[model samples]
Target: MSHDPSGHPAHLGRPGHSGHPGRPARIADVAALAGVSIGTASKALNDTGQLRTETRARVKAAAEQLGFVGDARARALSSGRSYTVGMVTTDSFGRFTMPVLLGAEDALSAGEVMVLVADTRDDHVREAHYLRSLVSRGVDGIIVTGRSADARPPIEVPVPVPVVYALTPSTSDADVSVTLDDAAGAAAAATHVLGLGRRRVAVVTGPVTARSAELRAAGARSVLGDRMTGEPLFGDWSERWGRRAVDQLDRTHGRVDAVVCGNDQIARGVCDRLRETGRSVPADVAVTGYDDWDVVALASRPPLTTVDMRLDELGRIAGRSLLELVAGGRPASTAVTPTLVVRESTAGA
Candidate 1:
């Protein structure tokens, strides 16, 4: 009998074999079971080419019945793709990367694509090594991401391949990036506070040097205008900073009716300090936060009214962009607009 490379009888993998005998099911067996040509079986299995829906379904059901799985090498040869994607991130903590990665996976999994994550921890050497490895493995595409919204240098790849940035944008305008519209989100928060008749608004946010901070402050400023109480209080992105900013606002801009915080942590801190100082939220001061981080926002004394950055949607768009690029289409950079989630903090006001 003819033998396979593994010294097994080749008949075990031949047509009409159910794979029950010491060997895995092959496409030939699936084609025989489905009563279709090998070519049609391949097209149906790979989800390529136009075919009658019922015919494809029958082929898939037959393959499933036989527990057939196509070989990676053969699939790659037929489709000219490894069916693998790589996600490289500097955010080892996964604070921002996780959501984006999950969203990208959601989009890619539909096409049977697999994602390989490489956490560089902001290390250039490690990132370069990961890039080289991914390229060598012949990944179909790559997605680059980071912890912050700042623009970073484009990742260098020796061979031309599709690369998309998520959350963190690439410095080169030519590269496709999907990111949050921080300014618009902050503006929405400010508008909501204003609509509640809280005119004396104060802004507390992250470092003045941060692009997100700058954009958020600008967005709030554009709306608050002369009604804004003093200038924005820029500090670190922390609860301590938030509490301190509240104290500062009390001393410098007393009796502010509302505060727009940089993040959920800051907003929670502001709420705590406000209560300690005997100020009732919504009644005395309405607070709004950026980044609707569930751990902080939902657990706050009065769940924060915050901007939902829609990070998952951003990642999904980034994934779609990479797919388009891989298909030889030039997809434009996308800026996902944030949505405001109203909760007890602002609902009472």
Candidate 2:
């Protein structure tokens, strides 16, 4: 017996069996069990047309009993379509793409489609590799998600399939695109603060290069007009940035009556800092955040008021768009609007 490097019994290279006992239970076994011809079995297993219900049932039952899964590779080779869809994301998956991905996956699952996810870590070379890999894998469609609008996607590879871009700005090369209406969301946030009778509102946001951020700022400006005070404090979407930004706001501008955070994480940080400084939420200074992630909003001392980006909806729409494109439908783009979730962070009156 051969031992693996870890001293475990090696499962490979064994005598008589070549370490593996059975050929991955082929269609032949299914056919034999079903008492059907190989061609009939193949058709039944692939769900091709024109088979009687009873015949299809027997073939399916036999294949299931034998643990026979049709070869995806063979199907792709014969049909010229790979049933897989590829989702390519930038390196910062945890911060931004998590909700978007979840939404996309949920939508795809409902459509009986499988998604193959790849991470580029924001590297152009890696992005290119993954794009090529998806094409080589024979994926029927693709979804490219960028961290921000400023992301210059890597060179496009010609593939015999449709590609959808999500959460990124429109690309000349894409068939469909979907993103949040950041300006509307930001305006909503500003309106929430103004409704609370706040005249001076500060903003803590991520890099200005992010299109979503820029749009949000613009929206806030539209509502607040010249009453919006202080320069936007820029930082990454982290609690640390939130804390520091709040500290800076306090030092520079004194007690601002309202704050609109770039995201939930930053909002939480700002809220924490406000509590530490003995400021009463909504009473002393109202706070609002974007990306109304429930856990973060509800867990705060006073539940946070936030803008719901409707990430799941974004995903479903994108998935539907991609599926439509894959089915030879026309190219399309969708802009999902965000809604405000009112909580203790903002005053109702």
Candidate 3:
């Protein structure tokens, strides 16, 4: 048996492992294993200092082998940072916010940062309370999100830590935000139908009050031009609305070769209504949808060809932008273009 300078076993008889039995491993043990100074070991472990890349890797490897974990409280005290971030959302059901949160976690976890979630459920007073609480906790930054893709008022924080908007955007041009390009998504749908030799395309979408609905209509118009049968039929975001819109289209626009819907629910409803009336999907009238929601899209009779907003990617970008802001970098707001997912609905077309 060999002993270290302090009369402890130099090795625990395990490869790359060092430290005495019945005691937690420390930085001193890491330093000894890596043949580096204690200060150098810390610098490497914390990813600081101007140590050589190999030296840092060696120190980190040694630390990992010894299972040496740093004290978060001590690190926070020394760095003057909580190493935590907050995510505020108005999506109580987590339908939209959950994917964004998961994406943010993927990026933030790489930095060893923790996230605190605050769901305000669309109440201003509740939002204010959550903001205050997060600020008081000294979060390094924040990411604001919501169910809609529309712009909302920027959140006000007492301490003014970096904030990044995800899914939902900030109305202020000065604030950094990452959002879906609804118009582009609609345009993609239009282009796809056009490529399938579809003419007389009619648009069925949600209420005009929603920015997403307006943008989507405009996008389809931009691509379809005169091929678009008539003005968009705007109602509500529901399957019933979708079914009613189909009836309205039949009475007003006559026969449409393709129907571009605002969302999966609407597309599914359109397919169902068309089927009931002896119109075979794709064979007679091709249909496309926005928001590739699995439950709605996949559950449709022939499934749906829809737009994927890639919300998770948007959240990831938002998280990275927040990190940049916390590090004093000014990241410009960005809009992510949605991708088209082809399915059975547009299989023949």
Candidate 4:
């Protein structure tokens, strides 16, 4: 370490820094404060290899006192790399995106990589702008996420960075994605109902326009076959819809033995409606739901038998996939299957 004009210790902290009052701290300020050349400060900040461990530590400490943020733009220009990942999502509320983004961030953090996330609210223009900005910033990769089991358009940026779509797939086969096995989840629900020896079955679920609802309905249909009664009783993703659907099934199908619900809220409603009509769950009727939302499932009259999407694991896999791509591995698509969490709702007494 070198001394200043007064021969005072240069790496102490604020005392070593000199600047116009309230002026923003700069790299030069960090170097002066750390008793190092600008080149050493840059190396320490960027984590460049072959740096002296003690010198780097001293420089970092000075930078903290100065509140200096390394110039990412300058580093990117000089090294042609930015050890950062950008995660884009429409779900700012994080619902589906949280677990996936956290998984990716945690995995990347262990490798000294950082993640920058943006919420586009599914806006086309905003999505384009964020992609362009992240590309220009030289992010190593990106992860795109949407609300449900569906497909969206690919990121239109021309940059070389890899983008992994999570929850929602990309319509482009060239782009990689990680999603749940929707069909398998529905099949499991239907099978559980059938396994309880309930031959007469019906479907109760959300809107017809939702791809998730359609796929789940198809999965249940494939399992129920001749045993499935009536068309899928489509309604909103709510308890009211579930209760109304039960009434509709009772009117048309007369004596249904079981029902597969699209979500726990609907399943809970169905159970309430069945009891109102003097039907005992699992004895007179067995009901199963998807997306084992514990708060709703566990609070049901009889604890619900539901499918666990394992979203955190899906997020982890998605993170792993993006890291693999960043490390020069071939981009490959993957599908994660959900699990069945059995409870009293489908348990035959």
Question: What is the per-residue lDDT of model 1 for residues 1-349, given as tens digits with 9 covering 90 to 100?
Answer: 4344352423333444465666678887777767789999988998989999998998898887767877997768667899899999999838777889998999888777889999998999999999999999899999999999999999998798899999999999999999999999999999999999988999999999999999999999999998799999999889888888889998999889999988888999999899889998878899999999999999987889999998888888888888889889999998999999999888967
Measured against the true structure, the TM-scores of the candidates, in listed sequence, are: 0.87, 0.80, 0.85, 0.80
Tens-digit lDDT track of model 3 for 228-318: 9988999988988888888999999999999999999999999999998899999899999998999999999889999998988888898
Whose TM-score is greatest here? 1
Model 4: lDDT to the true structure = 0.84
Off by more than 4 A, model 2: 1-21, 46-54, 173-175, 226-255, 276-278, 293-301, 347-349
Comparing 3 and 4 on lDDT, the stronger one = 3
Of candidate 2, the 10-residue stretch with the lowest lDDT total is 7-16
Clash counts per candidate, in order, are 0, 2, 0, 0
Model 3 lDDT-worst window of ten = 7-16
Alpha-carbon RMSD to native, per candidate: 4.4, 7.5, 3.7, 3.9
**Could you tell which candidate, 2 or 4, scores higher by lDDT?**
4
The lDDT of each candidate is: 0.89, 0.78, 0.89, 0.84
lDDT of 2 by residue, 1-349 (tens): 3345332223322333222357665777667667788999888988897899999999887766656766878877897877778988884666467777888888888877788999888778887788888888888888878667553543487655677777774556445678788989989999888877899899888777777777788888888886688877778878788788888997897769899988887888888888898887878888888887777878876788999988778877888888888888885687889999898888552
Superpose all Cα atoms of candidate 3 onto the true structure and report the RMSD in Å to 1 decimal: 3.7
| Candidate 1 residue pairs in backbone clash | none
**lDDT (0-100) at residue 179 of candidate 2?**
78
Better of 1 and 2 by TM-score: 1
**Candidate 4 ranges beyond 4 A from true positions:** 1-7, 10-79
